[model samples]
Target: MSKVILITGASRGFGKIWAEAFLKRGDRVVATGRNLAAIQDLVNEYGDRVLPIQLDVNDREACFAAVNVAKDHFGRIDVLINNAGYGLFGTVEETSEQEARDQMETNFFGVLWLTQAVLPVMRAQKSGHIIQVSSYLGLITVPVLGIYNASKFAVEGLTETLASEVKAFGINVSLLEPNGYATSWSGDSAFQTESMEIYNPVKEAFQQAASTPGFFGQPEATAEAILKLVDAAQPPLRLLLGAFAYPAVKAAYEERLASFEDWKEVSEAAHGTSIKTGN
Candidate 1:
């Protein structure tokens, strides 16, 4: 069965690829971006199956309007992919408070508001999927990308809670954690303001770390994974999209475990009870 999908940030990168992939599979896609021109080719190729809409996920009214258009056009949205985000490379202190807020607004709250806009329709229909395009950095904090990482970390926790809350409504939430995919997420297109000379050392490190599009994991790879998940009888809560994603997640988990072990005694003492379970 063909699904009706609404994807934000569909102008390029993973969003763009996923829009094309779904359309190719006979799904109707309301492909949205700040600039529809970026995806003009998709509209041209897919015709009616691909509906291009101008949307800035950061804009609340625009987010709601996009959902409204999708619902009106297709009668329902089976999948909503929140793939609009960018990288803010700088230390937390080096980055201004407003910059941090902008990161959260785009990467975290942007999805939140958009999801809120779509939730009522999905709840009434009792079927839908929400895919959040996060990063390996979202799972683990990296130098110079603190603001970017913070936003993703927020998504990680927020989506975890959201999944449980909406499960009863037959709504599934999943995070797309793509390690170092060669997406526009690192280039000038995705780079945020970084004018702090104090961050010069770390800033240079991050610039070198950014991946060029189509070099690492291709956007198509992520699109394929998303399509596969869409057809699965039971989809997982988290989709680790690339090989690089797995290791980074594993390392972060291990580090968290080690840190817990190191603080076990203190934690046990603070809890006012024995924390040991004798076998």
Candidate 2:
């Protein structure tokens, strides 16, 4: 049986690629983007199988309305891919109030709003999958992308908790922590803060680090994986994509584990246990 899938940011990049992939495989797609015209081509090719809606994911009410339109049109939505977000290029100190809020609004809270909108529908039907497109930076922070890191981290926490809370309802939540992709994520789709000489070396180091061979993965390469995930009898709660994500995440987790072990005595002392915590 064909399933109905709703995807955000379907104008281009992963969203557009995944939408076409789903339509080709006989699934209905509610393809949404800020620019409605950008996705009209999908309708031109696939006709009614694709519903292109003009949507800014940050708009909470708009998110709910889009979900309703999709539910009414499709009868039921089987999967929702929250792929609408941009990278904010700035240090924690450099990120302004508005910039931080904007990053959270789209990257973090946008996921929240969409997830909230779909829960009622999924709960009533007793089945659905919510895939959140996050980044490896959510687990391992990097220089110059502080706000973006925070947003993804927030998403990780939110979606993980949602997974446990909704398991009894047959709802699955997965976080896709993709490595750096060749999509215009850092080019046109990114926002940069004002440059400061104090952080120029940090910026330089970050640039050099990102210049490693095969640092960028292709956007279309992930389409098949997503198809399998939604089709699976049991999908993972968290998934890391691309070559770079696994090793990077492994190293970050190892370092974190080492720190925790090193501070075991201090932690025990703080808990009023009889342990040596030589400060």
Candidate 3:
């Protein structure tokens, strides 16, 4: 059965690709971005199957209004792809307070607001899917992208808790942990703080590493992965995309587990005399 899929940031990159894919598969799509002009072509190409709406995810009222508009137009929203976020490039010390807050507003709170807005509709229907486009950085960290990592980490926590809360309502929540993709995400779409001389070496290292061949995956492939997840009868709570994501995330968790085991004696000692609890 065709679905009514709502995607934010559908003007370009992975979001655009996903919208196109869903429409091509005969699904109704609500394509939204801050710039309506960017998605006007989709409406022209797909006709009534695509509804282009202007939405700035950071605006709480805008998020709610966008969902209402989508619901009114389509009568229901079967899936929501919360893909409206930008990368913030800077070390923790170099990023300003406002920069950190702005990053969280879009990447974390934006998802929260939109999800809250859609929950009522989904609850009434008794079925829906929410896909959060988080980053692999949510699981692991990079040197200069501290703020971006923090925002995604918060998303990781939010989506996991949400899955448990909404499962009984037939609402499925999933997180997509994608690695660096060959999208505008790191180009004009990225946000950067003022450069500090103390971090020049770190920045240079990252630049060199990013310039390496095949460092980024293609957005089309990521879109295909998302489609597959939506088609599954039982999708996983977390799906990692890109060739590097699986091994990278696995190694990160394994290493952390090893460190925890190494300090088991010390850790237990700290809890000495604590009452034993029943499982």
Top lDDT model? 3
Model 1 Cα lDDT, one tens digit per residue, 2-82: 999998888888888888888887899998888888898987888888888998888899889889988998889999989
RMSD of 1: 2.6
Instruction: List residue ranges in candidate 3 displaced over 4 A.
Output: 274-279
lDDT of 3 by residue, 1-279 (tens): 999999999999999999999999899999999888888888988999999988889999999999999999999999999999999998899999999999999999999999999999999999999999999999998889999999999999999999999999999999999999999989999989988899999999998988888889988887678889999889999999988888989999999999999999899889877667898
Q: Score candidate 1 by TM-score against the native.
A: 0.91
- Candidate 2: which stretches are off by over 4 Å? 273-279
RMSD of 2: 3.2
TM-score of 2: 0.97
Model 2 / residue 198 / CA error / Å: 1.2
Q: What's the distance in Å from true for residue 240, model 3?
A: 0.8
Q: Higher-TM-score candidate among 1 and 2?
A: 2
lDDT of each: 0.84, 0.93, 0.93
TM-score versus the correct structure, for each prediction: 0.91, 0.97, 0.97
Give me the overall lDDT of model 3.
0.93
Worst-scoring 10-residue span by lDDT in model 1: 206-215
Instruction: Report clash pairs, candidate 3.
Output: none
